[model samples]
Target: MGYVLGLGGPYHHDAAACLVGDGRVLAFAEEERFSRIKHHRDSRSAAQSAAWCLRQSGIGWADIDDVAVAWNPYWPNYCDRIGDAELIAELLGPDARAAGAPRRLTVIGHHLAHAASAFYPAGVTEAAVLVVDGSGDGVSTSIHHGSPVGLRTVRELPYTQSLGWMYQNATTHVGLGDWTNAGKLMGLAAYGQPRIELPFLHLTDDGYHLDLTRYGLPPFLGADATSRYTDFSYYRDLKLAYAKAFTDAGVPAQPPGGHHPDRMAVDLATSVQAALQQAMLALATNALTLTGTATLCVAGGVALNCTSNGILARTPAIADLFVQPAASDAGCALGAALECARRRGDFTVPGPRQAHTLLGPEYSHAAIETALAAAGARYSTPDDIAAAAAHRIAAGQVVGWFQGRAEAGPRALGARSILADPRSTTLRDHVNRDVKRREMWRPLAPSMLDLTSWTTTPHGPAEAMIVAHHATDTAHEQIPGVVHVDGTLRPQRVDPQIQPTYARLLREIQAETGHAVVLNTSFNGPGEPIVATPADALASGARLGLDALAIGDYLVDLTASNTTR
Candidate 1:
């Protein structure tokens, strides 16, 4: 069996690395986790992440037979310089190459890698794949047909008519945040009615369209924005343009960095959200008609919009839906690696379905102990760590729960999560205010042992927190912390088979309280990446004022004195 290493986005944000052996993914990680920078927007490659992956897999640079990069430099359309291959070469250094490093380097198309990331791992015979994101290689969106053999692009749309751009523009206008804060805008949308009409954004026969000239918006959404990520002057100019557009559209622009959105801002957010959902549905319908398949797998940055995913899930056109958990650019690393494996004849058709995203580096008990001792933390070796954690949460304490291997994607799937009592009505605000130190408007998700009892919608792939579900009346009364203002919740359905330790903790929580749900959010404060190491967990717990921390078999009480007891 051959090993393939994939790298994504040194030029773009969310730089990441993934390693695939044969057809299975052995390791994956985002550069932000190690760099402690949100999105790793410093234009640095995933060298640290790739090194971590190689170390985790117990392999050296020579063991990798192929290196796949999630970019096509030959794409003549885009002018932006892409250097993922060179970055990997720099990462390997001169000594490794002198020692006779592996073999070949392959560059895959951006959207093709995205399609492979979704379709191959979906384990379906045939399906229609949709990739909607900010511009990639000058293409904003594309639809593909996937089978055991491979993927075929049926349709492609230019970046000029981008839904991601429209949403991001509205996000800035509404004072929610920038491109990274689209999810915040989505959460803010539920608070208001979609009464405003955006003349520039509309639907076409096959896809969506955005008239950038109409509002004097940015020339291209992601193309220009991504290239100028750190350019505050550019963002200021763009913000002014959007502000003027909002004024022209009859809605007053909300000032940036507001805790709560005003009525106009809320309405604008709602209008953009409604338009996005409609456009996504239209595109999905077109994809289904083109491919003649009931199964649909989606990737790319826009696939991370749980609100839109929920609307599509409820539609009758899609019978089965699978979304890449790490649908953002970070996922492109995994996609590129998978594509490399497939071309090498190592990855076969009808590939294995992805059960869980617990594919990152795992720490041993001794490592955890070493970190704890070095920190001189006050802790205890609990007989049952899960039970102890459950008791702490049942008592309305915000506990930091870190166990097993870290999750690969953005969502904290029990492995590196901050747990709280979902029943408390004020707990959400408390956590948002005191712990995360972010806006109170954003909603937290629940890790449920069984989601069927909570959601009214038909179940598909709630295993990952990629889609939102309409909460039942029972959920509203029992787990209000997880439910948003619109009565919808993005949930991670914890399966015992895949996440046995987390499931056991949920069971313990159920025994302590009547509900089998817990308020689960990523284990990090504002503008920080998810905790990756034992030291990361300890530092975050102390910094965030967590009541307790369950790391491996040990439980550290941050509320007590720092002295070891």
Candidate 2:
């Protein structure tokens, strides 16, 4: 009865929906999951996710007390800069506007929604909430203090000066994808050195200040004609250009596919990462000093940086840290919903989430069986699928694991993942070359049985794999497959309730090998989409280097060379 509907992203990417009642999240899903698109933008997918949320809650849309959309088109000066009035109008069309009337529609600021999604779900009362991303509404970053009085902004960092843009530019410089490959730059940074130091990274009394001129040209510079940074897409291309600039300035740009580890590359990555961490620290410290709050909530695409987050957690200014799982644009959906609930007195303070990423769609055994039968594929109903998969992994076989409800974030978790033995040192390279077809420098992540059991030396537990954590010497020796070049692992601790099936498989793998970890990657091939349908799964197995495919309850062995049909 306390349920309120949350909707986000009918007009942009990462569209999603969440239904909450009684201070517990009932159901949440991203439109991309159902649509099979990397980031859902189509109206059909957005509306379908909204409708699905209502159906899952067993309530009609009209029954909802309030409908919260994570964006406000009416924000002052919004239309003047973005010039997307038609798109905004389409988003506010009859259905969405109708849902808002009579109940009083609550239009939340895009940045505030990002901060709320991080703060409310974290169950933190007083903390520095830092929202950093490519661009939200118009701002690039915002810091806030969360308390019973609601979130209060400390300062706002405009999009014109963004650390996210710096990292994205570096990503493209190395010839990687932009929005998708920014993480690659994070990984690559560990291997490079920044030849040029810019004064813009210094902290100032006005808050964290960046001297744009020191970095050569403004990030917005057009590709051919410098000084114009476009949207996020162009933002990425500019970063790549800057990387080349670094090389031209006497810094060596690490060659793609080069087996040799270039010191310059490592130095560049270290400098940028250091600057990034310092800036974040300065921002967090300033927020705490101003708000007098010890606990912190963080969101936005930049909040996804696990390394920076770990630093924030350890900072003297912060006592505890909470981050939303879908901290990226996808989370704006839930934030939009919470904003509405706040106006109605439904969401008074932070509360515990009922579930994790498992809030997405679930397939019945019957439906999976029908798909397998129609494909004419052979499968196994093993006495224990998890154990069997563990055995295959111990034997060094790569497995495509699809189970239960899919994960809501960018991570694969255990569901919709490819699992491999971490004991194989060459596993990372092999996955990149043979399976992922991604950059060789890009490292793989591990699904650890116990996050605390592993050593997070230089950096601590990367529960979300948003940041990289150093592996304990003991862990490194035991699970060589998942370790990156810098002797770290981007790990996701499998919580029992959030990932029961994956947890069981990890337990089984540990029981056999004494190490409960697997090299887990997305369940898709290069340039292809993440497997969304049973057909997609089967097709991926047919084309890739997978040894077996586990879809729901059915287990398929692709090594047999037998076609599904």
Candidate 3:
């Protein structure tokens, strides 16, 4: 029942840490925020984030009762547990260990942590849980039934049949960066037709079949085979294979940095996307039948696919769905802590539902002012910061809105976002080109006060912007800037109670622009993590030439010095 620290990685991407006390998540953060790296792929860097969590929670190292690692060194095969213990000891530091800290240390399977993450935070009495991701502990996908008793495994698929690797390979084949660039692939899929047939994926009554050999890719896990993620030769083989496949298909591969992608790339993206949705639907159907539950909760990296989540939500098979906001490997840290607490009889049935992800660091007014002064920026304390920022957006200005704690996941909610008027298509293009410096085809998302007016169907809980919905005609006419070319949007519906200030801003925008939607993106430029501190916010705002920055209760204006708008 005491404080338990959960460490996610020293071996995986998106390293993170979480602290739990009295069966509740006290603090959770990804190492990327502190390291300033996109995914913080180096798991050793997670120590800094873990230290920050303890500091943020005002809990000393001596106060921590247990430490839980999200990786199992003795799963299916044995790894060097002694090396891992040494790493953990180093992470804890000699000074802390000398103070009688960390009474117990526990390690759990990776997919089990993923399941705990999705099932516990979902706050459902009983549901079917699905964990789908790249290879984790030799398993890529699993199905479980969650009840008051806990989660029970139903089925598991080996890493060799991974859907995640299939998508990642296809992403690279189409000339999108790599596995990290799957989101770009998903976005590009909207611009093409699904005419290309991928024979590697076959949907069945149970789960689906994925054959990597069809694409000239080798098995992800085997006695002698190594992970393709770290194998450069695998990529070389992939290039040659894709070259042959493209030549046989009579299409050319798209190169990076272009206004328009090649026809073949888009078609491939579309086909893969279609196949992924179908396969996910089939798998969900099987989970529902196996667990005999009407509600479903999903986690792991693949759960971040908002397009597939939208399709699942739209289908009649899934009555209710809960997709973890921080579904990536980073979220496994939180799940580990929760699982540890539950096993120790600290957490009760139907644990607290994570209504929001504003779990990272928060700055005070004095800190914001100090940072603002250090930046030598022109600023003022507005009577109504939301009203001021909304008026600026109404004047067609892109503004940085930094409020409360930073978000825990990749998507930027109201906490740390760049807000703009969503009425003009020109504004969207301008933000993409000048501010974001990303592909023109990649669409911006929206945070709305009333989501029902924008989307055509009920798209489950979108408080996290992790699910996409077909846009209604009203949305296209009113907020084209946030709408994609395919008439779909990944929208975040603001909850007044949880985000009162942001909801107030949306209301102000409604008064001025006659719509409750505003274009909301992460408060950082290209190749940077979201701003974690006021200094980060000010520096990014200045570098990106933002019109205004609403940090805490102060409004910093930069219109006099910048004329880009």
How much lDDT does each candidate structure score?
0.83, 0.69, 0.82
Q: How many clashing pairs per prediction, in order?
A: 0, 29, 0
Per-residue lDDT for 371-443 in model 2, tens only?
7887778688888888888888888788899897766777777778988888886766787788887767767
RMSD of each: 3.2, 4.6, 2.8
Candidate 2 residue 65 C-alpha distance from true site, Å: 3.0
Candidate 3 collision pairs? none
Give candidate 1's whole-model lDDT.
0.83
Off by over 4 Å in 1: 77-87, 90-104, 217-241
Tens-place lDDT per residue, model 3, 1-565, is 4888877754547889899998899899988898888887644546778888899988788888777777765556654232444655655554555565564467767888888889999888999999898767767899999998888899999766678877876777677776777888888999899988676567899879865475577555563345443454654665566555544555566676534678878888888888888888888999999999889999988889989999888878788889889998888888888888888888876987889998899998889878877788888788999999999999999999999988998999999999999999999999998988888898899999777889987446788989989999989998999999988899999989999999999999999989989999989887789999999998898889889999999988876674222
lDDT of candidate 2? Answer: 0.69
Backbone clash tally (model 1)? 0
- Which of 1 and 3 is the better model by lDDT? 1
RMSD of 2: 4.6
Question: Estimated TM-score per prediction?
Answer: 0.93, 0.86, 0.94
